[model samples]
Target: MSHSLSMPASCRASLRTSFAMSGALVATALLLPLTAHADQQSSETPAASGETASYDTTDESPRSAYLSDWYNQNVTVIGSKDIRFGPQKIDDIYLEYEFFGRKGPLDLYGYIDMPKFFGIGNAADSGAFDGGSPIFAEIKPRLSLNELSGRDLSLGPISEWYLAANWIYDWGHNSDNRQNTLYTGLGTDIDTGSPLGMSFNFYGKYQWENYGAENENSWDGYRAQLEYNYPLASFDNGASLFYAGFTNYDFGSDLGDGDSTRTNEAVVATNAFVYSFTHLRFLAVARYFHNGGQWNDGSELNFGDGDFRVRSTGWGYYLGVGWQF
Candidate 1:
């Protein structure tokens, strides 16, 4: 006795229409700030007499200013399916919400990842009730040191530097297991001036079990990540094409065993192509995950097992739409 759930055609049609309308509204909102800023800049007149205007000039370019103060605020909704290949093939659907914004000199970014399993009868009866819950939630805040110091540190391609911090929480699908992670580090934003913008970050992390005995002791680790986005083309209709990607590497000091005290735990990479239309953006993403040392041993499913034990690579794809204001 199994049951399944499927979305009705009417519901899907309604959702599509709602998204289109929302995109139009969001695009208008995003453009308003730019229009106002442009007007302000154009209206700037010479200072009266010998007096000098005290306009802020910390940011190097008008585009950067707009991004930091206005264009950075965005909300994205993504639907993705993850396929795990092993003796027991597992596939799951996830809905994700991502937000990025700025408050004064502080930049905030976060996401909620929710996993859902349809076509499964009652979740409670199938022991899959937890599928509707959030699988992970992370929030990261960064403080711009250069801006706060009231100095323009634009050297070469490097435009600004910041202090970054992250808080992450993870939950198990059907268990009380929970984990919390704290990260702090340094980061920089780079302006390539060639449609490609880059960012680099290095962080130290501390992880501990929040409610489960699965993780007995706390662990310390270090991570480095590089991210970039490039605009490929633009059309007169306000549509554009872009490429974006990120790579992350993690090293853990306490996850090793026996005589080994440090090990490379994981490396993850993602590449995406984005099609932008005014205030709406659609993205297709491809990702790869590599696990080693303690990570590979503990998360065996991620590395495969039995006949698929030799498979050490995992991949996933994502499709998403974003709205900005």
Candidate 2:
């Protein structure tokens, strides 16, 4: 027998109301620092002097420098369903938290994804014992080689280069279902200088993975990404915006077992519409995925009875809210 689950009307309405209130709080938080800065500027301005004051361009205030580096940092909380988008679906609610920021020159980005606090649905339907309960975390830190070397590596369109490393951990419902992965890569950042401020990234990565089960895998791959954002319209309090990105990955044959069948390839695309208030952002996102080869999940290789059957393609949607600091 098969079954389906859906959120009730009242629960969805309550979630919508909570999101509205959260957005208002985020806006207030974002405005307070600006308001303080404005007040400080007003108090510091010289009183009605006959002579005009000249500004110094070389010297920058400590507060201004700090704010420049940290003001745009943000954390987003999202509620999503069927994040994996599969033939075997995880129908329960899931919460994801993402963070993006900079610590000095190194750029940091990561997300934590897990099911809701309370578990719902039957054990078999939830994949409780099969390593499909969906708990994953990843962190990537990229060090700018150009900045560290104090040299410009720009070659026509490429603007910056970096040495990147990433660590990922995945946990299934049981202790026997776990995987850890590490990746080191060379990457470049490109600025297109277009009307939409489009950007691109290229990466050549070597990946190593260890699964709790018998089989393990390693491979080399290259990834390409394109990203852009546009402002659609403005309102008295906020603005509507559109953002989109695409990513492609190509991997070589498995290094450990020398099996071409164990290699993986994938392409993913995402689009979102965001509404921005004083300090908060609300967004709706749609994503598409195309997968091929034995490691279709992009993390580990799965072997079936006598062949590989992991290839899949699907789409999913998410609604989220973010607070900028």
Winning model by TM-score: 1
Residue-by-residue lDDT tens digits, candidate 1, 1-325? 0000111111111211100000011110000001111111222322222111112234553332223332233445544433221112234444444444444566555545554533332222211254434455566567878879999977787777878775666665534445567779987776666545566667887766543433335646788866654446654344556555665577765554532322346665656666654345666666565642223422333223243232324765556566533
Query: What ranges in model 1 sit over 4 Å off?
Result: 1-77, 81-90, 117-128, 154-156, 173-176, 210-219, 258-263, 292-294, 297-312, 322-325
Top lDDT: which candidate number?
A: 1
lDDT of 2: 0.39
Say what the RMSD of model 1 is: 12.7
Q: What is the lDDT, from 0 to 100, of the residue 64 in candidate 2?
A: 30
Candidate 2 segments whose C-alpha is farther than 4 A from its true place: 1-77, 85-87, 118-135, 173-176, 202-217, 253-263, 292-311
Instruction: Please give the TM-score that candidate 1 achieves against the real structure.
Output: 0.63
At residue 47, candidate 2 shows an lDDT of: 17
Q: Which ten residues in a row have the lowest lDDT in candidate 1?
A: 18-27
Residue pairs clashing, model 1: none
TM-scores of all models? 0.63, 0.62
